[model samples]
Target: MTGDIFSENHEVEYYETNLLGNMTLSMLTDVIIMISQDQATALGVGTQYVIEHGVTWVVAQTDMDITRLPRVHEKVQVQTRGSSYTKYFAYREFWVRDMDGNELVHVGSLWVMMDIQSRKMVKLDEAMVIPYHCDRVRRIQRLNKIPKIHDEHDIMQTEYHVRFTDIDWNSHVNNAKYIGWMVDVLPYDFLASHVPTEVSIKYEDEVTYGDPVLSRGKFINTDNQIQTVHDISVNGSTKSIAEVKWKKLDKKGSK
Candidate 1:
């Protein structure tokens, strides 16, 4: 398992669907992270393994391009492979495809090993790098930088209480939950008329239990696409930011 790619199939549960009956972006992200973890576990470098080594894997940045959204009850296949690594960062690629083998989504992510107690990034040792059998290639290149969303007059803002379920095994809010929070603040009419074609997120800090998070977003309409930039903050400090680009769908379902 150390040097091999891994894949898994999943049924899009009803709970994972949105009002449109298609898998929500956040839930789809959850599935991608879950499968990545499963593959890491099989390769012997997952949560427990990293924790035992006094560090944990944390996502630094992620970019996903979705061509089609899986519908509820649809069985989808997810495949992942470790692609490359440096002293402090590792890259991985993931794909989600429908039963007909048409790719629905492609994702590229950057991860860092962080010391649990100090919460500082640690350099990857041979032990950590060897097992991944990185191919030294990337399906989608790592994002150089995600632009910060500045405060503006028309930006929408909302406050949310961190719930227990939002926390993951690491005792912090899972990254995908941030996407959900961002979407929750979008105008209902916009959501009803458009569908996201791409999403990129950069995790700057962790949000923990008892932390009150504020979500702010700015929507932009271009000639061909609608874009939104979101920032999640705590105690007036920014924690994470995400950007989503959407394409309008007509009443007849044409993009």
Candidate 2:
């Protein structure tokens, strides 16, 4: 398979944002899911099509950055393009833009093809991928480096056990669940006051079912916003599965 470009339209809903009219991290994640679905549809291999063949695409890693919030009732064009494909992985990029062609967010993701029966990552088969070719192709830059948590001295403490429900078809903790965990550890008052302008998640290990994992978050305040880094560790291997840096909408001068 060569590659292809895919695009879709997004109409922001009232429920997708916080009380301050800013987008939530959950909503951002939703947009990424929709864009990826659209991309697969463009390639004739959307979700239902994959399910028909008993195959699925699992998101392995992602790094998304947001510059501004898309307002309610505003229209955004979600554009996606296939970046590259290795034996076991494929790279994709997505962007959200306004009608005037202003960029709002950038999202990069790594996807792996799997043997649904074996439930393991498998090499991409030519027959399964030959349809996504495009005359237009672009390269997605890979960030070999992962984002680091700046402050590790916070008194914040959280302990949670990973359940079987947390594991996806890929047999790893669903990437979205990490975001949920990060959100869960935050103070409810803080969540009520702030909106997420950006979110970045880096997956380093697979979280098994029934594993008792501990979550820790460090909050670092910037000039006008706050950055929170979360750590998910099991058996003393502390790898950051996700990091979020967001602006505080409740305070003066907050971005």
Top candidate by TM-score = 1
Which candidate leads the pack in lDDT? 1
RMSD of 2: 4.4
lDDT of 2 by residue, 106-201 (tens): 887887776678777777664555566532224334743445665567636577788887776657776666676666688877776666666767
**Counted clashes in each candidate structure:** 0, 2
lDDT of 1 at 94: 85
State each model's CA lDDT, in order: 0.83, 0.70
Roughly what TM-score does model 1 have, to 2 decimal places? 0.92
Query: Which residue ranges in model 1 land beyond 4 Å of their true spot?
Result: 1-3, 136-140, 252-255
Q: How displaced is residue 214 in candidate 2, in Å?
A: 4.5
